[model samples]
Target: MRKEPLLLLILIALILAPSVQGAKKVVYVAKVEGTITEYTADQFQRYIDIAERNNAEALIIELNTPGGLGDAMMRIVSEIQNSSVPVIIYVYPRGAIAASAGTYIAMGSHLIAMAPATSIGACEPILGYSQNGSIVRAPEKIRNFYTAYMRSLAEESGRNTTAAVKFVTEDLSLTPEEALKAHVIEVVADDVPDLLRKANGMRTKLPVKGKGYVVLDFTDVQVRHIGNSISDVLISYLSNPAIAYILLNVGILGLIFGFLTPGWHVPETVGAILLVLGVVGLGYFGYNTAGVILIILAMIFFIAEALTPTFGLFTVAGVASFIMGSLLLFGKGGGSIYLINRETFSMLRIAIIVLAVLLGLFFLFGMTAVVRARRRKPETGKEEMIGAVGKVVEDLDPEGVVKVRGELWKAVSKTGEIIRVGETVKVTGMRGLTLIVEKAEGDAEWQE
Candidate 1:
């Protein structure tokens, strides 16, 4: 009986030990919506780190974006390519687009899935302008180089090379069903659970260092979401063309206001913070150096116009330069390309032109007023009569009163020329409440 009890205990121990030794499988889902900026890159890196730390089975990135910066896209692609865990790109929730840079990211992923109503493609290098604002196009050579790079990524990911080329060269797009049929994507699913079901038992070749290839078996997986932090979300939104432009304008206007009227530190502080944020956002969007230089030149012109009267020339030139610079500020990347929208640019141009004209008029009037004030006669005490040419209003015994510009003032004569009432004289100096006068050379007839 004791031997039987011992055998039963051993059986239970063996079953429990196997259960304890087997690890629970997990699937990490990361959602990327909107423009993929530097914050997106940071978040992706963070999620990758998290996956690595937890030894997750795979990382699924649900991507919904119009596109973003080229450099950021390249960084993301590099990260995806180098990731040890299987990275799946899924375009979800229907009506979402994976244009430009998004195409590169999806192609870079180890596995790509799409929602039934979603579409992808349009990997063509748009040279200038975006849905958000205007952007300068890359040089032809550079664009070709990026095209070749994306092609290589497609090849590595086992996507259709011909279709990939068409995407870059012709801006071809594909719906989920079409993408699957063309081999641009692996599968189509309604949601994450369905994705997990379809993804389960799927095998992928891992790029392990020493091993030739390790197969991924994502069976019986636990799903863990990797959502963006509030800061990350804010950064991503602020990196948009519209938001960036607003921030840039606010920062510049605040700074100008602060400079014009000192002692209000709040505008300056806000301006400094906004300027930093705008610059960082522009950098994240891959702005050209020339565009930035042009913007600086525009600001210089604006300040110059404010300080010196340029007859509206500097103001006009500044507005023109600013519009052009803003139009060419950012560039298109593999995923998201930043460009100024046509309507926005047109409105901005009009506003800038109007502002310039108004400022020019204000400076013109203000400068004229200042010149007039400088030429006007002094209105204060005795010093006001120093250079005045006036007539004696009363007979003076070397000291009396005089009339100057319709005002009577106390006066005296330095040269002992007897001054009679109505005798014309010129002011030489003054004593408290008294003006010293000299007989006018050409006004002797008036003294007769």
Candidate 2:
């Protein structure tokens, strides 16, 4: 009787085994609805890892994007293609699109499904750093390469390669039904649960969760949604084209303000922090180097106009550089490429010009005041300077240093006389940065 009871228990356990496994079945879901970036790739990778570790049925990425950097898109594609768990890319939320980089990502997944009214394609490979990425025509070589690339991805997934090639060459776009009919996609569902139900028993060529060439069985599954983390939000904000641009400009202005009004460390300290962060974003995104240098130089020139004696030249140069740098500061390099559309670029351009003009006027008037201050004396016989007597702090070999009105000034000997340090001199005139100085009468103290 004991043996019979033990045998009955063993049989019962065997009968319940399949149901136990099915009960544990889960589907990990993550959603993306923005321009793709490395941060996006990182977020997706996290979800994929989670699903793989838990041995989930699939990790679905519901996406809606107008494309993004090529490098970032490639990473998303790579992770999806090589993942151990089944990766389903669903263009969801109805009326969403898998455009440009989005299309490439969708094609690389083990399974692709779409919601009603959702669309895909229009993924012509843009030259990484073209003047404008969206509408600009790519080179023939690039077109051919991408055509072949898309075809390869489609071929590998056992989808319609011809339609995939047209996505690059002809910029073809399709709705859910069209993609399903063309075999570019495998299923169309309204939502996550619906997608899982319809995708059951779907044949996938790529390996999933370490299994190969098998039909997926996703029924009565538990669903877990992986939302973005704090880091994701931070990186997404930092890498945004508009936000980054504003950060860079505001940081530059803050620094300028701090310089104009010294003795208050608040603006300088805050500006330094913002400027550092902005540079990191700009450089991290691969913005043009010349653009960055120009903007930095503009700062230097603006500071010089305030602190040094320049004849309005620095002010003009600063404004010109600011405009040019603003133009080149964004959408000029490859990684995280953005602000490529003409409409957006036009608005940015207008803002840059307006800011530059306003700044130019402010500095110009400020320089005029400096000129008037320098020319305070009667111009009857004097030329560029107020006559003031002071001591030489540095030796003058046609150029040196002097003190006038208890303030230091760069000076040059009026008559090519080499006056040693500690000698007394008279400020006869001033021009630009240099003060015209001459030996004071009855001056005795001099350095040998």
Best by TM-score: 2
Local distance difference test, each candidate? 0.74, 0.80
Off by over 4 Å in 2: 1-23, 128-134, 259-263, 283-285, 309-311, 331-339, 365-448
Each prediction's number of clashing residue pairs: 18, 1
Q: In candidate 2, where is summed lDDT lowest over 10 consecutive residues?
A: 331-340
Measured against the true structure, the TM-scores of the candidates, in listed sequence, are: 0.69, 0.73
| lDDT for each residue of candidate 1 in 1-448, tens digit (9 for 90 to 100) | 8899999999999989976655688889988888777777887888888987787788888899878767788889888777777788899878888988899889887788999888898877756555455555667897798779878987776779899888887789999989999988887999989987887776552353233344566667788898778887678767765566657766876787688669978887898788778787766655666666676677677667666745567767776777666655653352144454466456645654665456456555654665567669778766765666888888777788888777788888888667999778887888777788888778443321
Candidate with best lDDT:
2
Q: What C-alpha root-mean-square deviation, in Å, does candidate 1 show against the real structure?
A: 8.8
- What pairs collide in candidate 2? 84-209
lDDT of 2 by residue, 163-264 (tens): 999999888999999999998999899998888888998877566645776578787788899888887776767776556766787788788888788899
CA RMSD, predictions in order = 8.8, 11.9
